[model samples]
Target: MNNLLIGLVRALRHHHWLRLLGGAFMLSSVGNGLTQVVVFGQLLRWHASPSALTLAYVLATLPGFFGSFFGEKGCRRVPPLRLLILTELLGMFALILPLLGMFYHNIPAMLAVQSVAAFLAGMSYPALTLTFKQGLSAEELPAATCMETLIFSAQVLLGTGLGVLLFEVFSPLTLLSIDAVSFVAAILLLAATARHIHLRPLQEMDTPPQVAVIRWAGLSILQKRSLLLLPALAAVGSPAMALLPAIAQQIRPGDATGLALPLLFARSLGQLCGPLLLNGERLRHYAKSNRHLLMCLGIFLAAYGALPLLAAEKTTALGLIFVAHLASNVVFALGTFSVLAYFPAQSVSGASAKAWRWQTLTAALATTLAAGLAAQWGATQSLYAVSLTSLAAVALILVRYRQ
Candidate 1:
């Protein structure tokens, strides 16, 4: 643990660009955490139906498909740093739509606002990945990725804990306003970082327009198989995660709002612990066997799903949730590390964008289906079904892996 902490400090000290990007990521992720809590809290307060919640999540995420396509194309033309800054600026303005939605108690308006925000965030992803790939050395990539995940995890812990504490005192509009300010802060930080660094434009990197598509097509069968699993994982994971607030309400009907903070804190705490536990050599070893990571994720999620069925106590449930998220972050971090290591630096952005596009679409569809299931079978039952589905997906993938 001490060694890991020392390494983290050294990595940040050595990479100026990484430090800046980490700062920007921290601000953005904390805002995201706050937005998630506020939006879900507002919906629950409105007594939103399962279908309404489903639609909101789908609408917010579906546009990312188009955004990823455009983002990949845009980055090939514009310098990634410039594109990143522009997206952040646009994101700052987009927060207003949600503020308006909150003011009017209009669900549709909030949905639209979330869609716009998701689109801009999707568009920024490729640019952000490219920026990192361009700035860091091959040897530095894993440490940087791990550090990024750690920062995100830590910020989530801070943000959601803070959000829950503040929700009682602040209105939705005020919470969202705080998110907008975060975007502005991130934008300023990126701009300052840009002045100090020299990023070669895509054209200068000699990447042809068709290279991304061709590169993906040319990946090894194992690589392709591993990447394809992402969507299935999303289908399994996203819905349960999206319905967390609802699940909290189910777990504590008398004090759903009160219980939510503890649950969120548990999940966030797990996220923070995951990377810390898998740092350095362990992360690399796991990245080499993506199938095993998927298997572990499926198993842990299944256990988490069964907790409610066992009539578990609140403390037990929280402990399981923490364990579940810890496993999730480990899998996610390893998967991301594998992708980054497999692709050449120049192709990383396009490849990641393409992957994200499909993953987002799958998550939207799965969330919608899960919502319908939850409406019929209850949230806990629906979560169990999805967890089983994920395990089944893993089984199928493992069968193929043996071939």
Candidate 2:
């Protein structure tokens, strides 16, 4: 553990650009979390129903599809430092506009406001994605990926609690203003540190556009398996925490909200431990074995689905499932490391972007489908459906691995 911590510090100090980008990423992630709390709290203040919250989420995320496409376009043209600075500026503008709207008491159209951020983000998504993938040299991939996961675990475990506190202590208006300032800080940091980010000249860049497309269309057999097959299978295997409320309700009945936090906190602890375990020289080997890693995820998710029957009570079920959920995160982290370590750079056009996005969409669909199924087939039956989905993903992995 001490060695890992020391390695992370060494990497950060050794690469000034990594330090800048990592700082920006952490700040941006926290700022975004705090902003989300304020937005959700404001909706509650307006007495918006559950459906309204769902609509807001859908609105915010829908733009990502387009953003990833358009964002990469400009990123491909500009120098790395310029591209980094511009993306920060675009995000700053997007965030600040809604904040300004709130200050003037002219509440922007949620859809349009949300879509704008998504659109701007989509344009810069590739560059941002590359920040970790290619930002650090190949020698740093293991440490960088490990450190990034730790940061993510910290954000998830503590950020939610902090966001809640901030929401209570200050008004949404205040929160929005703080978020806008964070964006400005990120933009300024990139502008100042622009010189350190190195974009290696690629001979691949000079290839004719059509030839590039044809080449991407013709990826290696391994690349296709990692980018396409793995995600498609993981989609159904990815469990949705959105269903936690329903599960919590069954246990605590009316205190579902109260129980939700502890369960999620438990899950974050799992996320933290995942990176800790998948370390050492073995990290590279683990990151290469997508099939087995995903199979592990499927198994854990299947166990999670069976929690209702295994425990004979809500609290017991919750405890067992929390452990299962943690296992799922571990599996997810491993599979993800595999993708980043192996995904072909030429495949980034959009094929590889589907990785995280597809998992998210699949989880959302699973939640909605689970709810409807539960209403008709009963909770047990609904859980069985989830189990079946996960098992099916496992089957896919097994078949692919053998081939």
Candidate 3:
């Protein structure tokens, strides 16, 4: 932990813009955990119908469908620093409206405000992703990426703990009011520091006739690879999550959630620890070791297939699930890092944005497929089928890992 703090301090000291950007996001992430639970709790308090809640969620995510295109355009047209500051300002307004709506007990108004904020938040992810890729020197990037994954996990952990504290100790309204203040503070900090970040990189798609054409044509070969390959492999891992409640059924019968939450907590631990495996040395080792990484990723997916057989000892099954999640995260992180590292500096942001779009699309498709398979085969056999998909992914990777 000391090392992580020291490493982040070094990264910030070396790169001036990163400190402000990272600080702003750290505040946002911290605030989001509390805000999410509070808003959800408030909607339940208002006796929001299931359909109304679902529509709110659907509306919130609508921006993500077009987020990459807008983010890439913003990168092309506006300086990333200015774009980031603008997004922060928009986010502050989004938060303030919701806070006010809570006082009026207006569920619809809160949902509207949240949807607008979600759209900006969605776009900001790619913006920051590009900023990190562009701003950090090559030497700083490896350490920074590892540190980034760890810090993000820590943010989730710490923020969740604080949210639980607030849920127990304070009113939901109080929690949201604090969330609004955090956003305001983030905006002020961004406004103060972001102006000094002057970047004038040549915009790759500036000559394009339309936004869609520009986004499509600007994708690099690596971006194409990430879009085509990674998401399918990710989907191949979906059965593990899909069958969790089912697995809980096998172990605890009627108390499915009783065991399911522990399984999730175990997986979360894997997420927390996974990125640590990709140190600077390991990354350098695998820079040309794409084939090796592909194999390991295949192996993790294959293990998920074996998950069904482990049900005799549910405790042991949880342990394997933990390892599988860890391996998946490590391989995925390294594969993505390779994509970011290998691409041209000018095109890295576009590639990263495209990857986000691919994941978003593939995740929806994969979830749909996983649900269909689960419905057909039940829990145990469905995982066997899921494992077969991983095997298929492995077959595909073996052919293309050369790239």
Candidate 4:
């Protein structure tokens, strides 16, 4: 706990602009959390099919996968900060699509809005990454990442809980309106952040395009191999999460709406605690020897998948979900830190963009597959299948490390 607090304090104190960035994310995420709950709750109430639920997850990520390509170009041509602000502004308007959808009770229209929101989010990712890379030193990166994870977890925790409460009283339209307002607040915060940081376009940096490509090309074979594992690593546990609503429904039949709050709470609490337990130093160490990290990830993921098979009780499932998310967050922290730490400052944006493409694409695919399995078989079986596939992918990566 002390370590977590110290790390967060140090990171915030070191970069004053980070507080602005963090604030922007916090407001945006809270709204996002509320919006998610409202959407899922409505779907549940309408008795949405497994395919429809899975389609929502797929749309949320698939556009982002394509947007990363454009983001890489934007990062090089325009200043990252400027690009980030623009995306936020556009996202604010995109919220209208969903609001309109909700008014008519059109699920497809509501789902379509996710694609727009996700694309804008994807477009901003490389810029967001570059903002940190430009602002903080290597020594500070781990702490910043930890702080980021904590903020995300807190938002999920607060957002989901608040969403549940608000859903009981407000209409879906009202909940979505709150989310739109959040985007406005986030844009204002980003504008403040812009005033504090002065960054050149990536193309204007010391490394020219040719030189950047050459530098990337010169990376060691092991480093290149490590990069390939990112998609698989990211896809880990995503299937289970994508199927979470379905899982809740299966576990407690008629009480999915009531049960979702605690399940989300447990997952968020686990994410909140994860960084505190692992800390930046441990994450850095794990990054250096990712084989052990992947091994641990496979174990936790398998256990998370297998638990549902053994027990039918909601309490036991919640405990397992918490434990699984805690470990998953650590793995995510390690993966993110490794990518940032591995690349040269000049190449980080491009590499991060490429990584986002594969990660989001694979995650979308995994969710789709899991959803199909759930539709055909069961949510539990789908989760187990994804977990076994993840373990096999891990085993392949481990074997490559040996060679």
Question: Which pairs clash (backbone N, Cα, C closer than 3 Å) in model 3?
Answer: none
- Please give, for residues 228-302, the per-residue lDDT of candidate 3 as tens digits: 444654555555554554555555564443354445445545655776655554564554455655665666665
How do the residues 1-403 of candidate 1 rate in per-residue lDDT, one tens digit apiece?
A: 4333455677678878768877876887677678767776777778776567666777767788888887888877887888888877887777776677788888787778668767876787777778767776666666756765665575458778879889889887778878888888888888878876666544555445325552555777655644554565566677777666667767677676676667777888887777666656455566556476666676567656766664247787778778888777776666566566666666777777876787789888778777888889988778778767866776676566532
- lDDT of candidate 1 at residue 115, scale 0 to 100: 85
**Model 3 regions more than 4 Å off:** 1-9, 35-63, 86-122, 147-155, 164-178, 196-200, 203-223, 226-233, 238-268, 281-322, 374-384, 387-391
* lDDT ranking of the models: 4, 1, 3, 2
Using all chains and alpha carbons, the TM-scores for the candidates as numbered come to: 0.89, 0.74, 0.71, 0.90
Evaluate all candidate structures by whole-model CA lDDT and list the values in order: 0.71, 0.55, 0.59, 0.73
Tens digit per residue, CA lDDT, model 2, 282-350: 655554565556656665666656655564554666566556656655555554455555543433434
Best by TM-score: 4
Instruction: State the TM-score for model 2.
Output: 0.74
In the range 1-403, model 4's lDDT, one tens digit per residue, is 3364577678788677888888888888788778777777877788787678777778877898888877878977877878878887777777777777677888887787778867876788778778877777777777767766765576567778788788889887788788888889988898999898755444564454423342446766545544555576657766877777787777777787777667777788787776667655665456556576676576668657756664377787778878877877776666666667766667777777777777788888888889889998988888889867876876676566532
lDDT of 4 at 249: 75
lDDT of 4 at 106: 85
Let me know the TM-score candidate 1 reaches against the reference structure. 0.89
- Candidate 1 has its poorest 10 consecutive residues by lDDT at 201-210
lDDT, model 4, position 392: 80
Q: Return the lDDT, model 4, position 352.
A: 71
Candidate number with the higher lDDT (2 or 3)? 3
Give per-residue lDDT, candidate 4, residue 108.
80
lDDT of 1 at 7: 59
Output the lDDT of residue 62, model 2. 49
Off by over 4 Å in 4: 1-5, 151-155, 198-217, 306-313, 401-403
